[model samples]
Target: MKENLTDSAYAAGWALVKRLPEPVATRLFDGIADFVWRRRGKSVLRLESNLRRVRPEATDAEITALTRAGMRSYMRYWCESFRMSTWSRERVLASFEPEDVHRLDEAMASGRGAVLALPHMGNWDLAGAWVVVRGMPFTTVAERLKPEKLFDRFVAYREGLGMEVLPLTGGAGTLGKLAQRLRAGGLVCLVGDRDLSASGVPVEFLGEAARMPAGPAALAAQTGAALLPVTLWYDGTPVMKGRVHEEVPAPAEGSKREKVAAMTQAMADVWGEGVRAHPGDWHMLQRFWLADLEPRPEESVLPDPQGVQ
Candidate 1:
């Protein structure tokens, strides 16, 4: 009732993936690289344009290489995520070399809820599975997908990993649930990088401004949760680095708008650097900028982060 789902394609696809052994999955992933790499659809073209817009310094050759790498990473991410159900703790741990996991551990130990603000860079789905394996009580907001079947399947898989999946709408209600978990010293991972409904605050990214959802910053400010920067990448091996940027202090002291703006800007800076570092890893397929859309907002301006709280 909370989130609309799609047809069972995703569920069906994942079911097939789960049935395959690791070695088989790995092989098939590589075998289908050519098909995946072919830029045949509008989605892939839009993805390239987004990448170029973010990293204008990239040459056509570099863009192509990054695109190919992205496809491979995408395939591998799916394989690894489905395989999580069968993977041992040691096997799952092998994929992660947390450059700053201690930051998260320290926060969790203090019994204050911490927010893991993730982006589209690298394998976050894999990262979530890793979190559950490490015994962190994890939860996240997922935007509703059209149709209902697909959403249900995605939630079921996440729940299977011992995570509490919240629909983005009912997500606000789940904040207290997340806060209680945090108050108990647990962790909640939310993707802060996407503008789900184009109703996010604007922040400078790549070479231009892009909108990012205010949910993460708003929740952190509201709940007094520590907002942590988490970036996942392929270091030849999929690795996740969790860095405790300065804690997202509540706007309780300053103009709420100013406080939110500063916090959202900080997140933008971190995500921008990641996109620059691995341009292809950013998976923004939809038409993103306000200019790209047919009708612009009448009162278009940078999002007032403080206003959201």
Candidate 2:
């Protein structure tokens, strides 16, 4: 009953937001962000804590200011996502100006496929829509949320935008399916900053230890695909901005396990650079640093079905 209520509420909210005028929606979201920030809600506090790791040198006042901006940026992502389905192809293409898109273009042209690893910043759905508008639809995994109806709604939403949505809980075969898609010259985009699996690869990020998903690296290594790190951020404009970093080449020599670890760490390093440049744009509202993580009970770990480290 509770799950149904939550799902219905979210669906209703999305419907209402989608119908709102752009200016009205923007103003409404701004007010919502201000209220959340002023209330010091849990999400806002978590975002502030994550920002501290990105900008270690920031004083309390600076962190406070940054958190408020981060809340606004996060709200903007939600606003854009709710309305993106109605965006025209031309508008979608124009909304995202990706720097170094040729890197992805070249990889696709080479028939080697491309693995785009991105952190949770900016409006990734906008970036994905741009890719689809350019004639290549990508595949990505979505975490199954509570309330099956809500999960289905999200899958439908992304699919409506030309993404092939795969369930993350689809078991061991999920990685094989992604690898197969890559080998066939398909694009696979993975959110690489946070590790959702139990067997994530540990790496140093923003001067602290944290685990990140290794699926991007593993997929590239397994299929001989180009691994590219991409970052997205709003530039205080209606248009979203992004950059595709140079490919993080697979190791010339190493065991498969060793190579996966090295590549994941390299991905983290590049992500750190982007986060530092646009600290408020990163929407990491959960505990990320190892120091901040609470202890978990010991259990026998199974291999990640997604092939993440």
Candidate 2 residue-wise lDDT, 148-186, digit = tens: 788888889889999998888855678888999999999
Kindly give the number of clashing pairs for every candidate: 6, 1
Flag clash pairs in model 1.
Answer: 5-147, 5-148, 6-150, 113-182, 256-306, 257-306
After superposition, the stretches of candidate 2 with alpha carbons farther than 4 Å from their true spots are 295-309
What is the C-alpha local distance difference test score of candidate 2? 0.85
Supply candidate 2's per-residue lDDT for 95. Answer: 93
Could you give candidate 1's per-residue lDDT for residues 1-309 as a string of tens digits?
322222444555576887886678888876565475683365556667777787688799988777677667666666676566766778767767666678787777777778888786666766777788888858776665445566566677778777788776545676667677666666788877767354678877765766877767776776677888777677664454434455555655676666777788788888778777776566565566655665544221111111112
lDDT of each: 0.67, 0.85
Clashing pairs in 2: 199-309
TM-score of model number 2: 0.94
Which stretches of candidate 1 lie above 4 Å from their native place? 1-8, 31-33, 170-172, 196-198, 238-253, 295-309
Best by TM-score: 2
